[model samples]
Target: MMTYQKMICDGFELNYCIKGQGQPILVVGSSVYYPRLFSENFSQHFQLIFLDHRGFGKPTRAFKQADYTLDKIVEDIEHARQILKLDDLIIAGHSGHAFMAVAYAKAYPQHVQKMILLNTATTNSQERQQQSLSYFEAYASAKRKHQFQQDIALLEQDLKREPERRFVHMCIRMGAHSFYDYTFNATSTWDGVYPNMEIIDYLWGVAFAEQNLLQQIHHLNMPIFVGLGRYDYLVAPVSLWDAMECTPHVKKVIFEKSGHNPMLEEPEYFDEQLIAWINEG
Candidate 1:
């Protein structure tokens, strides 16, 4: 692993940690959280670097609304890339972080060699939220639904108790919906990860909700891999992705037995698919 580096921009102490060798894939989400999600052995197949944006990275101060805007976050990524001199990158982002990867690609296409967007939503809009709910209601097993209800019932009290940990609390409470194994505890993945709910509210609930990344830019040209878990309900469903304008360059693959964090739940298969995609490109 290379030395962990931090870049301060827009009052956010952005972190980027490099590990492994080969094609560089800038993993955008959390320096702590995403690093734990990927197989540590990925160091052999590619140069995987995990990065933190405002929502997941430590903030120097409370951000004014403009400070945490999507445009600024995209530029923050560019700034990190330039400062680190990352060249011909295969930028990757999981879940909502995929928005940053797409936005960065659109803004600085020359810097990107390819893309790997994992378990991302097409749109984070209310309609999509409702669709996810309906899917859960209609298809989820009674056992899963029961666990979800029982687990979510504790969220209110948990949040009230540790207001600062709202994000971690919610994710931990949503284990039934997040992992293939209903009782899988995600506390480890989020152990040292800091979440700024203020920034998350704007980015996940507002900024990303209004944008459709697939339709955001045309002629991206590079091979873009979209990996989804068959059981991931936290983000938009696979059907929504199927409805999008999937150009020839976009390759979407679904993991049959995994949930939101497929790389961890199915590490070997994830590495195989990801490496094959990289090699194919």
Candidate 2:
């Protein structure tokens, strides 16, 4: 069973959920879409805490675009930790959230016992962006051409018809291209997910443009586990190599048959690797 909780952190009414009962690990970022899908297995071995970042998941206080900086977001995590009375947690994040995990570990090294970065990169490079776009074009030209085109068309139509739902529609479209195995229904994956467009727009658009953590990651001396999907073009697989190069103490795994969400794509292997890494001394 999962227990929902809330706290006032850094002037934001933060919402979080707790499950299982062992070593505590805080999983942050983008819980709006498929929150449970990523951490279901980890819950068995660890007390997984999931939190909705500022401007997301119904925060108590409204925020401005200037409030979404990496530093402020990290501060929110720390404030929540202090409020919850958690000690030396294992911090984990996925995609851009994984970048947040890296930044958090860098700023508050004393508070984090370990760090887990999933399907993420250190910086958003133009080379990576081009490669991702090229991969998508090639993918669309392949056997799934018709289906890919249809998904894009549907996404564009949704954006025009319901601009407020742009975040949801964008995620669905991105998931279609991000996943290697498209057998899973995209809409079903997005079920129960509530996205805050304002948060997505401000953070990813404005703040991320000025954010880069490559130089700071080397300062972290804690055990770091990085996972990347072979088919992940959104962030590019090369970013995994870049992360491994920058961080001194690190272990990496590549999900060959999976894409962005390896936990969902390859659960059994992901769980085994995660447990073994956590137990390693």
Candidate 3:
């Protein structure tokens, strides 16, 4: 772990931790959480700064639905960028955070040099979610399916016992779908995470679900990397992304032996591919 820091805003505080050196990469997600997901060796090729978006930073004051909308979240990222005095940065995100990263790039393309998205699906609509479920049923090993069943059987009980920690409990329970090694325990990775369910549910279920990303992505001229895990069943099928074409230098890389968190599950290969892409014209 590295030394942690904070960039407090008007109503909330975005915690950030920094490491590595070279080109700056602003990772848009939980400051504490995202930093743990990438390889430290990334410092050799880039400066990795993991900063939280408004959603993960849980403000004490009351906020309306309008406060945490995708636009607002993207602005929060811009706020962090300006505060840190970062320019021509590489914006990166994992999973749902990828929405914020891409949205930021769309809204402020001038500040971005490139973009990196890992384990990010095209959308999070009900249809996509259902597709992932069906894909899991059709493709997952029997052993993996069994573990999912076992984990899910306990989900309701866990949620009931800890309602405030609903998001964390559900993620922990979904180990089968989230990690390539279905039996792997990921509770430690989520140790200090505190999610605001209202913001998270709206963003994951609504904002990203209806996002017209292709049109927005087409306008970004910088290089982009979309990394996906072949075994990840939590998002839309990887084929959905593979089939689509965009105007930018958008490259897709698939990690055969990983799931949702390919950067963590396949860091060496992830770093190799990512560094290569970043350094390319």
Model 1, global lDDT: 0.84
Q: Which pairs clash (backbone N, Cα, C closer than 3 Å) in model 1?
A: none
Model 1 C-alpha lDDT per residue in residues 190-266, reported as the tens digit of each score: 89876888888899889999989768634577888989988887874788777444477888888988999989999
Runs of candidate 2 exceeding 4 Å displacement: 30-34, 125-127, 138-141, 239-248
What lDDT tens digits, residue by residue, belong to model 3 across residues 1-281? Answer: 36578876657777888887777888888877777788877766777888887778858577889888999988888888888899999998788888888889888999998888888777878888899999999999999999989998998897788777788888888999988899988888888888888888999999999875555566678888888898888884788785545444888888998999888899899889888888885
Cα-based TM-score, every candidate: 0.95, 0.89, 0.95
Best by lDDT: 1
Q: Is candidate 2 or candidate 3 better by TM-score?
A: 3
Worst 10 residues of 2 by lDDT: 30-39
Between the candidate structures 2 and 3, which one is better when assessed by lDDT? 3
TM-score of 3: 0.95
How well is each residue in 78-194 modelled by candidate 2, as lDDT tens digits? 988888788888999887787678778888899998998888766665555677777667654364445566677778777888787686677677765677775345777666556
For model 3, the superposed segments whose C-alpha errors exceed 4 Å read: 245-248
Q: Rate the local accuracy (lDDT) of all candidates.
A: 0.84, 0.74, 0.84
* Model 1 TM-score, all chains together: 0.95
